[model samples]
Every structure is written in C-alpha cells, then in structure tokens.
Target: MEVTYLCPHCIGAINALDNIILSAKTEKNKHGLILLHEEIWNYSVIQTSSINAELGEIVDFFCPVCHASLNTEKGDHYAGYIRMDASGQESKIVISREYGDRRTFKITGEDIESYGESARKYMYPEWFL
Candidate 1:
C-alpha cells in the first residue's frame, strides 16, 4: 500500500511513499546549544527536521506550503489529517491524539465503507470500526 503525508492546514502534500512514514532522532548543535533533533525520513531522504527544547519534547508539525501548524489547541502532539490513495480508492483520514498515547481515527471518502474498513484493518486502532 502507498501512504501520503499532507499538510492538514493547507491540504498540501508533504511526502508520498510506497511504505509507511518513518521518524528518527539525534542530537545536534544549533546556535551554540546542543538540542534534541528529530527528522522525518522519506525514502531515506530527510524531508523535515526540527530541534526540540528538551528531550522528549513534543514538536509541532507545520505545513511546508502555508507554514500552518498541524496541531490544534487540544494538545502538544500531532492532530492532523492525511490523504490516502490506493487501488483507485481515495480517502481522507483524520488522526487525533490527546497526548502521550491515546489517539482517534476517522475516515471519510466516497467509498468510506470499504476504504475505511481497509484502513482499520491495515493500520493501528483496529477499533476504528
């Protein structure tokens, strides 16, 4: 299956991959201070990177096109929507989380019954049903 990461604010495509999105972190020096750096990797190329104020700090994702934050006032974690297309099926998936761990998923599309079901089966939150 193919997955596409988008800017929920501007509905701009961030990265499209044949596989799932991957993330990694490393410490880097910035402005003479060492900071925790995290990056989103797409096909082994760094797509986006950010420096955190401290370790385990939750950084917000921004739209590359409009520079709008992907998270809302609800929490410090990611709470954005993503567009997925597979086998001629197109759908928008809403990803929401309170913080730390809990997350909610909502799917909408012309064929939500089948596309959403497929997403629930392949992705996390099997309770999406």
Candidate 2:
C-alpha cells in the first residue's frame, strides 16, 4: 500500500508509504534515517531540474534535507565559478557546464571575495553607498 506524507515545503499531501514484505531470514534493515535523508536529497534534485551533470560528476548544492544553506567552495571542471545571493546570505562556487561553445569556467579567489562583498552591498545599499 502506498502511504501518504505531508511534504514540508509544498505543504501538500502526498503518498510516502510502500508495501514491502521482509523475510525473517534477513538479519536486519541496517539502514535508517541518514539513508532516508540521502534519498530525500536525491528526490529534491530530481524534482527541481532537468539539467544534470555527466556521470562521475556532481553539481553539489545545498543540503535539501537539512534546509541549511550551502556555499560552494570551489568550481567544477565545466564552469569557472558560481555565486548565490539569497536573503542577504552570500554563497559562491566554481562550476562548469557544457553550454554551447563555452566548455570551461573559472574564477579567481579575489573575484569570489569581491563578488561576495558586492552582493552584501547590493542587499544593504546604505552600508556601501
């Protein structure tokens, strides 16, 4: 039977439970909540975008399960750098993707720092202006 769950983000009702017959021969269900969290993260990624990285490549983002905002420390092989400005919180990462003729991306540490400050200033104009 498919069980229903109330999604925390959408605030909507959804099915969550699944029927599974466990054999008595099995010792234990070794996995627990952490595994569940990992699954949740994967689910979020699938639900959010159609674009995806290639095999062996991962575009790491915030931990969707924990809802703790994440910052990218370094870019990937495809993109040089990425920066995010959300709710006055600044985050940055260097990423790469195959976009038309552009194959690689890179950003300097100084540029990242400058971008962070610029984001902060944009959010609070009185402080910088």
Candidate 3:
C-alpha cells in the first residue's frame, strides 16, 4: 500500500494516509488552535517547531491570556467571531490557525477544507513543537 502525503508547502510528514488529512503549523506562537464545523481559530502565540498533524488528533500549544498550556481538538472544521480592521466588522469567518513570528496565521476556508472529506480532527493541543 502506498501512503500519500500532503503538499510540503502545506503539511508535514513525509508520508500520510491518503484518507488522512494533515495540517502543518506555519506559525510559532499559537496559544490555542480550534477546529470547528466551518472555521479554525488560534487564540495566542505559540513558539515551537514545525507542526505535523493528522485528523482526529489533538495539538497542544498554549494559552494567550493565562499563559497556560491548552489543547485543541481538531474536527472536520470550527469557527469563531472575529473583528476585522478594528472597524468592528464583526464577521463570522471560517479559518485555520497557524502560529509564526509570535502571531497567529488565519487561513482561509479553502485552506481548512483543502483535505476534503479527510479533514483532520484536532485534539489535545498541549504539546508544542
């Protein structure tokens, strides 16, 4: 059986199951990463190494406010409210969180569902690096 892998630019791991979705952390400072039905959110900064993840898995990072460690369970998708441009656009956007440069990278919906039906489920995001 041949194991398919994700695009190096997008996911880690040299080989991942074809039916298995993958996510690579682009950012470093990710306090929290959540995967909801249609959106992905990152709470704070997370300083660590490259992230290589699979579906139905938990990625442990950190907490922005309390600076405590946190765990985020990945689902098919997830979402949260976000304020845009400080204008209070208050948009409910779909996205994925990738930590880098002490900032969280908000990925577009296309990026979240890039893996198709094999979307990875985030879980127990307390391990950083």
**Per-candidate RMSD vs. true structure?**
8.9, 17.3, 15.5
Residues 33-60 of candidate 3 have per-residue lDDT tens digits of 3322221232322222344334333244
Query: What is candidate 3's CA lDDT for residue 46?
Result: 24
Report the C-alpha lDDT of model 1 over 17-118, residue by residue, as the tens digit: 332232322233321111111111111222233433344434444455676655555433434546555554434443332212223343453333322222
Is 1 or 3 the stronger prediction by lDDT? Answer: 1
User: What count of clashes does model 1 give?
Assistant: 0
Residue runs of model 3 more than 4 Å from their true location after superposition: 1-47, 50-63, 66-75, 79-81, 96-129
Residue 88, model 1: lDDT of 45
Candidate 2 per-residue C-alpha lDDT over 1-129 given as tens digits, one digit per residue, 9 for 90 to 100: 222222233323322232111111101212112101112112121221233233343332222233322223333222221222223332222222211211211122333322222234322212111
lDDT (Cα atoms) of all candidates against the true structure: 0.38, 0.24, 0.28
Best by TM-score: 1
Compared with the true structure, model 1 gives a TM-score of: 0.42
Model 3: lDDT equals: 0.28
Worst 10 residues of 2 by lDDT: 18-27
Which prediction has more favorable lDDT, 2 or 3? Answer: 3
